[model samples]
Target: MTDISTETRSVVIEREFPFPSEKIWRALTQPHLIQEWLMKSDFKPAVDHRFSFNADWGSVDCKVLEVEPNKTLSYSWDAYGLESIVTWTLTPTGTGTHLRM
Candidate 1:
């Protein structure tokens, strides 16, 4: 007999940037800016909008799940048989922004 576990885990990374949340939000939501940092994508910051990120290896299909202006963004990331949700949270800080992913 074989056993399978359905337990799920989360990995969180937090960073402080010396830029405002609005600026950080632009890098995350804007397709051109996103392409500069992440994969080439057709991402839009609107809920239910489907998009993809293309890379030399392959492509990742995703859909916007949530968006809250410069505060939060969540989406579904499906690739290589692994389906997951990626969320980004931006908090305004004294110096700049606190980003959580």
Candidate 2:
């Protein structure tokens, strides 16, 4: 069989929330808070801990790779046939939170 390889592209999603940086950071990092908006169920965060979410598209399993307080977070999105790193970075604005992916 011929060897085939694919290049992975990173996706960047930017959003501005009216909440403070700490609040936005908690929504992104804290499992319970995340579930309230983005997830269908509970999520746990620990090194190598797998978290599952049931969405309109389908079920997705992601493993926590790294976590940094109020700044950076990295996880492996393991669903379908695609495995990629998803990172979230939060920046504090004068009166709100700036989120970058």
Candidate 3:
């Protein structure tokens, strides 16, 4: 019998930004801003929405999983035989916003 299986793991990166959640949220949801920092994408902060992120090298197939204005965005990333979920969360902080990825 041929066995097909895949292993999954979670990766979390956290940082504190001196910027308000609203500002950071704009950069995360706005295609133009995302293109400046990440890649050219048709991303929308809409759940169940499908999008593509493109680059000079290649592109990745993605689907939005969850979105909470100024709070969270989660999606599926599939490319090069690897599949992963990336979730970004922002929380109000005394200093500014706490960003997690």
Candidate 4:
């Protein structure tokens, strides 16, 4: 069981990575790398691509909304009786790239 709130709002998360955007992009779009951090499934970077993230408990059905190489990536996350859009923005900073989720 999980808490489900009626009110909806977008949650933003930001992190500063001490590496270039290409490296981070690979980790984000690559299925193997993503599975290492997120879940096990076939994930691609093509626009409108539908994929799933599978775990022991359940899975999430997602569709790619937007994809800009190493710049921005947006997708739909639906599961557990909830649906939300998750967008990741990578901005090049002075020393590294700033990743926002």
Candidate 5:
């Protein structure tokens, strides 16, 4: 007989940016802007949209799972042999915006 079990966990990273949610949203969605901070990608802020991030070391295959303009974005990140989902949430704040990843 064989037994198997599955476990799930989540790691959240939060940051407060003194910028509007709209501005942060652009940096996360727009490909050209993403290259500046993240990586070179053909990413689009649309559900089920397939994209890839290319780099000198390697490339990560990804697919957009969810998109909520200026609010939330979720995607699948598959690199090497590990698969994970990355979700970004933005909340309006008195100062600027609250970001959670």
Candidate 6:
């Protein structure tokens, strides 16, 4: 048995990638690339386009909320009826793009 009360309150993940901002941006926004890295199931990028992610627990539905070019992306995590925000900040470095997630 698992203690649901002991579960973590919130999860925040931050990652940095050594790639150009444009490249990372595409991977985040583009549906095909997103399906490759993020989810194993089908995904579409239109606003209010409901999709499912077949996970070990169950399938979760999500809808796109907002998209800002190379900057910010937000969506609704329908499984929990919560709105989650994901932002990407791109800074040009001498060698490559400094991507902050």
**Which one is best on lDDT?**
1
Error of 1 at 25 (Å): 0.3
After superposing candidate 6 on the true structure, give the runs of residues whose Cα lies further than 4 Å from its correct spot. Answer: 1-10, 80-92, 98-101
Q: Best TM-score goes to which candidate?
A: 1
Q: lDDT (CA) for every model shown? A: 0.96, 0.80, 0.93, 0.93, 0.94, 0.64
TM-score of each: 0.96, 0.80, 0.91, 0.91, 0.92, 0.60
lDDT of 6 at 47: 64
RMSD of each: 0.9, 2.2, 1.7, 3.2, 2.1, 4.6
Q: How well is each residue in 1-101 modelled by candidate 1, as lDDT tens digits?
A: 88976787899999999999999999999989999999999898999999999999999999999999999999999999888999999999999999999
Model 2 misplaced regions, further than 4 Å: 1-5
Alpha carbon lDDT at 57, candidate 4: 94
* Candidate ranking (TM-score, best to worst): 1, 5, 3, 4, 2, 6
Model 3: per-residue lDDT, tens digit, 26-75?
A: 99999999999999999988999999999999999999999989999999
Select the stronger candidate by lDDT from 2 and 6.
2
lDDT of 5: 0.94
Q: How would you encode candidate 2's per-residue C-alpha lDDT over 29-89 as one tens digit per residue?
A: 6767887888774565566777887778898888888877788888877788878888888
- Clash pairs, candidate 3, are none
